[model samples]
Target: MTARPVIALDAMGGDSGPAAVIAGAELARERYPKLLFRFYGDETAIRAELARAPRVGAEAVVVHTATQVLGTDKPSQVIRRGRGTSMGLAIEAVKAGEAQALVSAGNTGALMSMAYLALRTMEGINRPALAALLPTLKNDSVVLDLGANVECDAENLIQFAVMGAAFARVVLGVERPRVALLNIGEEELKGTEELKEAAMLLRAVDLPMRFEGFVEGDKIGQGNVDVIVTDGFSGNIALKTAEGTGKLVTGLLAEAFKTSWLTRLGYLLSRGALRALRAHLDPNAHNGAVLLGLNGIVVKSHGGASVRGIANAIGVAHDLVVADVARKISDDLANFHAHRPAAVDLTSAK
Candidate 1:
């Protein structure tokens, strides 16, 4: 029999705290009985919620004790002075091999900092990238360097592509995914010096992936590239813009139908279409953000995530552990580095 995938979740990290976490956990337990969960938070609050609405057959939700670690706490303080904090404990659980993965809707900075400090980086990766998954018209594409490392070098960008490619292959179940460097235009001469240089390096390297050349921002959701690579500064701005635009459109549609009777009638006529649109716009569908290049799997969910959002994030983390994504990523990169020339010395980049 296969061993259950164990995950350590920071229940106190999100805006919805123990209640949202509890609901999400219950949903996941019912949806996926094979998953084993360990929640870290205040024992009293969790037990109180449990008393009010107990989840039957919740043996998977083990309680890990921690005093407190708010979303506003500093990463330095959380890592050093604070020992029993929820985020701290979750990272340590992965480090100690007690958990296959760690999921948190806490401070993104703290999660990344703690994961880096705890599990460290894999070989050939100087700084790990936070790959926010975007559901495109076709397959999902990863936008990496999502505010993790603002300043990345040519070598860093190239290595990010390798990592992103491996990630898509395992988590996405693509045999050989298409990898592309995100630039201003599809032409190789369009992006900044770093992007152009990185594209050249990637062109020369013998990656396990198929290089789809350069891709622009407009090509993100066009199903042209499976993985979109860029620096944190650029990637973060693009991601926020896409998210903001999606929200604006959704809000506008809702207001348009609510204002007048004719519009309401039209909306009623297209209620099924609107429901499909709303389901597509739900952030829970794209809730998973993997902090790639770490020794273990660590997924970060949106801090403002709802119950369904947290549950979906848990589901993503469960897949990563079960697929041995961490090991596969490290091995794939290791092979690519051995074949590539001595350019950046990625063997020491970790």
Candidate 2:
């Protein structure tokens, strides 16, 4: 019999508290019937919520009490006082090998800091980066450094590209995923020195991925590349801009449909297409953001995620654990470094 993979959840994290957390776990339990869950939070509150969720079987869940970590808690403050906090305990579970992965809808900075401290960076990795799936016109693309390291060097960008490619292969099942560096223009001479240097290194490497050269901001949503690599500063800004645009378009569509009876009739007639559009554009559908290059799996759900969104975040963690993503990334890194030419080291570039 196969051992059921365990997931540690921060039950007291997030805006909706334990109730939504438990409800989301129920959704995950239904999707993965053999999964085991470790709930870390106020034991009494967790139990109360779980009791109301008959679908989240008691046999499948273990509850552990924690002092709770507030969303506003600074990363440094939390680290200094986070021993028994829900987020800390969940991460500890993963570090202790009691759980294969940990999921939290808490402060992003706090989660990243604690995960980095507890799990550390994987072997051969300098820093852990935040990576997530973004909906695109052609297909879903993976983007990295969503909000981790605001400033990065050539080596950092190269690492991000490799991690993003691996993520795309595992998550999107893309064979030899096309990797592209986000740049101001598609020209080789365009953009910052770090980007140009990173591109040069990628071009010289004989890795398992294809370096598709440079991709502009507008081409990101066009799905021209399977992976878009950029520094955290640029990646986060692009992500927020895309999210806002999606919302604006959605709002405009709703207003248009409500503006006239004919449009309402048209909406009714195009309900199927509209539903598909909504699903494709919904951020909740892509709720989980992963911290790659860590020794243990860590998934961050949106602080204000809905039940469906939380469930999806749990799903991402589960898949990463099952896929042995950390191991794959380590293996890929090892292969690349072993075969890379001696002249390609750009680690010290500013």
Candidate 3:
């Protein structure tokens, strides 16, 4: 890790374009005073936003590019003809060692495709998983395979656990984080043969994490586990459901509070508590989702994220770079393979 880490930004990404991207960079700069930036986008638009944020402008170097990835662009299309685009150039900065990490609010599929193609997966990692921090009752829990690998085998799940545990150590400040597989029921035999085999292998290994048996959907918010492992199919659905439920609850509360004068008075009295709840439920607070197992770091911010949310996403990139999370993951994976149990054959298990 360097004293000052430079982040590559796809300045033309997201719904608000350079305005939100530059504003977010300014906020991130305030949080991390030693951070620097390389902004890639239309020079005129990027410079226009930078003018309003003198502090960030002083620390940023703009690279002009008229091309930008669209929300509707397919990953295959980007892979074939995206090198000149802002997103592609930003990713290239990381691969070329000019930037420590890349942050983009562009299309998720496109970003993943570009990153995987440019950076490739780390050695010993068969696939890269999308991991994010989810707010929980005790603290934030790391959930992986959010939308990267739809189908996974026992070996893939085990690898996700190792990578996810490394992420928790760096981001969540948890030592020997507890890990579990997401399944329909808590019973040992409830999930598929792949999951049960993965659990058995995890239990047998002497890894840096504590392998909790299993976790159900209802228990995700309980915060009993530090890392939750699942295939992208299940993990993505769980993430979307949680987001929808949060909005539903907040909307219902707003309507109830506006029903009558008595309720209005009650709302005024509970304003402080409501504000606290709002902060917890804010998606911006947990904006950055990393594509783990890549040689270089790549963080995906929500396209519709606000300035604060985008800043938080940048903050995630900064922290991961400073902590040297990629190296930690590499080291852990090496340790796992070196000490792998001779009796367990991943091929046979699969």
Candidate 4:
């Protein structure tokens, strides 16, 4: 039997509080039976939720925290005074090897800050990038620098491609995943110097992934590429736009179906397909966003995530731990550095 993976949870992180965190753990327990948890938060609240989820309680150990990181708190504040907070304690568990991974539904900035400071970056990684699976027409695509470093340069984007490809290989189970840099146009001369430089270096490097040059924003959902790399500014905007579009399309569909008897009948006929679509677009299915390039595995769950969403986040952490994604990333980065042409300068011009 495979060894159980222990995960640390920031029980006081999300908007729904400890109850949702525990409930989500219970749900994850059902999916991954060989999972263990270390919950960090208010003992009383955690115990209360655990009582309602005895199965999860059976596999959980709660560590009480006197304070918790607030959504409004800045990243710097959390880094300086957050050691005692629930989020801080949870990350500490991972850093200390008490847990293989950490799953937090707290402030993104705070999570990133603490994880970065505690775990630090990997040997070849300049900065950690936020990566997540985006639903697409063909299959899920991994997009990185979602909001981690807003002003990344060519070297950063190149590193993101390497990291993102490794993530795709592990999570998506793709061999030689198709990688591309997000650009304004597919043409080589269309994007900024950073993108052009990144693309040039990526093509020169003999990496594990298949570099597919550049792709436009419209091609993201088309799923022609397995990994999309960009600076955090553009990547974050693309992510938000995709999310908003999914919501808008779903909302419009609901309103359209309720317009008349004819539409209602049409909806009834296509109910199954509609449900599938809804499931495909559900943020809960893609709840976890990983802070890649960190020394330890850290997954960020949406603040407003439901129990199911939180469970998915935990599942993502479990997958990363079991697959040893960090090791794969390190190996790939080492290969890239070894094979990179001497003429290519990886320094950031910004």
Candidate 5:
């Protein structure tokens, strides 16, 4: 923990290629002088970007990688091949203690696969969830399992809540973030037995978090919950829907302003407000989608992210290391699980 934080970035993993990734790395260093990076990708491509970037201390951000992880390849197959692939090699850097964490804008499946294989999960976490930050009226919300796992039961959901709490506390500075399960209704007995049982499970547990009961879908963008937990199926839908809605609104706003002189003039008047709204809703501000429950921090950025997106993600990795989130998670889980009930009957409803 005393060593300087070095982030392992898969330069070739995002859709933009190694150029954007390298630029992001430079931006990160410029923003944080103490920031160091280990870029993993094709040597030629990485070196080219470094040449064009602002002068950074040589050897501070080294290209310690070989091949690249492609979007087309299967995660399982790629993990097996172990082709000096960017994602694979990046994880290796962390596994070998050369880096504090790994960040990728490439394939989500590949990142999770390689991360689980290399770092494994924390002691008490049964499965890790991909937690993304979505903009809302209350600022940002942590939505988990954006499609990391297809199926999860009550216990798994509870675990995600705990991990999400620890993360929000560390990163967002929320001492006790409110946890919510996505449901059709807010009533305790609203959904299936799984929902009700999970609610009970969450309340029964002694987590270092605040469980505020279940949240509805409409509450997602309204900031009703700090941590929105759900099965992968539903969580993925909410994530994609919110993204689509944001784009749709922004596109419509642009079109409306271009149509007429009156609207255009009005738009000019409102441009400042629009920009502020855009910035608040901008996904880049929440660039880092953390793969929680992993032993090491793994930040997953949008595959088609711009240089700015990657840069923000690097800043996220830096923040995570500074907060010592992983160690805190390990410590919290050790205590929580130790006092958990042996077993709770969660039988299916008739």
Candidate 6:
């Protein structure tokens, strides 16, 4: 653990191109002085941005030239013949043991495809899920399958629960994290057949988490639960809804503050609190979306994330790598299989 972590960067993938990636790496170095980086993209452009930050120039950053992948490229196409692209080479660095993790602010589907194809899934994972840390009333909670697999059966849902619980344990440091399935109502009779079946499966297994039956949509941000599990179709919708609502509330507050001189004075009086609120609701603060269940760590940042946002994404990758999340997931799955009731068939109901 004493050795510095090396992060591979896909410098040419995002909306802002290599400039934002380089700037973000510079900012990350300030926080992690010993952190190393491998910049995969056009060397000339990477160097140009590197020159802009003197402090970063002094750090250990190796430039690796790569053919850029366009946003218009499809996942299927990328998986077949995009190995030489910046995103592809970044993932290759992790697979080749050259870097601890890979971070990209690029096309979500393409990143997932490349990561899966390159690093492959962990032992027990059928498919990797997209997980995001959502801000809640009490604290942030982990939500999975943000947009990875649209359709999931009972077995897939159960796997997501285990993965999500491990994520909360590592990232949130909850000893016995509370895991819940997202449903229409809290009652056992509610939800589709898949939800009910998944619930039955979780209850039968002696997993490390506390499986709290079912949680409704409104409770997602309450922080009463540490992890929320759902299909990608539902999880993705909920994520976008929450993000949109946050932006709407922020805009309303800003407009309200500018309404009158008295309101403006009130805003001035509450400047400190407002600053705290801004920081709390900042999308950039939670820019990293982790691709779970993969053998190697892959973090996807928003395509339009700012410099600080990109730095935050890097921090997510760094934390997951340090926590050895993949190994923990493997261990947990091993326990699940060993402790599961003999009559219970995990392959059933799917």
Worst 10 residues of 4 by lDDT: 341-350
Worst 10 residues of 5 by lDDT: 341-350
Superior by lDDT: candidate 5 or candidate 6:
6
- Model 3 agreement with the true structure over 266-335: per-residue lDDT tens digits: 9999999999988998999999999999999999999999999999999999999999988888888888
Which runs in model 5 stand beyond 4 Å of their true positions? 1-3, 54-57, 61-66, 341-350
lDDT string, candidate 1, 1-350, tens digits: 22887888887888988888777877776677777777788877776666554442245454667665777788887777555788788888889988888888988887888789878888767889999788677767877978898889887898788778877876677878899887777765566677766776677777778888788787787777778898998899889988887889889999999999999999999999988777776788879799988888899988888888888888888877777776667777777667776653332212
Q: Please tell me which predicted candidate would have the highest lDDT against the true structure.
A: 3
Q: In candidate 1, which residue ranges exceed 4 Å CA deviation?
A: 50-66, 258-260, 342-350
- Each model's Cα RMSD: 4.0, 2.7, 2.1, 2.6, 2.2, 2.7
Give the lDDT ranking, best first. Answer: 3, 4, 6, 2, 5, 1
Q: In model 2, which residue pairs have backbone atoms overlapping below 3 Å?
A: none
What Cα-based lDDT does every candidate model obtain? 0.79, 0.87, 0.93, 0.92, 0.82, 0.88
TM-score versus the correct structure, for each prediction: 0.90, 0.94, 0.96, 0.95, 0.93, 0.93
Q: Tell how far residue 322 is off in model 6, in angstroms.
A: 1.3
Q: TM-score winner among the candidates?
A: 3
Taking all chains together, the TM-score of candidate 1 against the true structure is: 0.90
Instruction: Report lDDT (Cα) of residue 196, candidate 1.
Output: 69
- Candidate 4 lDDT over 1-350, as tens digits, reads 22989999999998998999999999999999999999999999999999999778976899998899999999988888999999999999988989989999999999998899999998889999999999999999999989989898888998899899989998899999999999889977688888888887889878889999999999999999999999888899999999999999999999999999999999999999999999999999999999999888999999999999999999999988888888888898888888777775534322
C-alpha lDDT (0 to 100) for residue 225 of candidate 6: 93
Cα-based lDDT at residue 117, candidate 1: 83
Please list the residue runs of candidate 6 whose C-alpha ends up more than 4 Å from where it truly belongs after superposition: 54-63, 344-350
Summarize candidate 2's per-residue lDDT along 1-350 as a digit string, tens digits. 22688899999889998888889999998998877888888888888888887777576455576577887788989999886889999999999998999899988999999999999998788888999999999999999899899999988898888888888888889878999999999988688888988898888877768889999999999997899999999999999999999999989999999988999999999999989999999888999999999888899999999999999999998888787777778877887787766774444432
Model 6, 1-350: lDDT tens digits are 52788899999978998899889988988887778888888888888888897666766465566577788989988888888888989999999999989999988999998899889988889989999899998889999999999999877898899999988887888988899999999987788888988897788777779999899999998999999999999999999999999989889989999999999999999999988888887889888999999888999999999999999998888888878888788888898878776654434434
By summed lDDT, the worst window of 10 consecutive residues in model 2 runs over 341-350
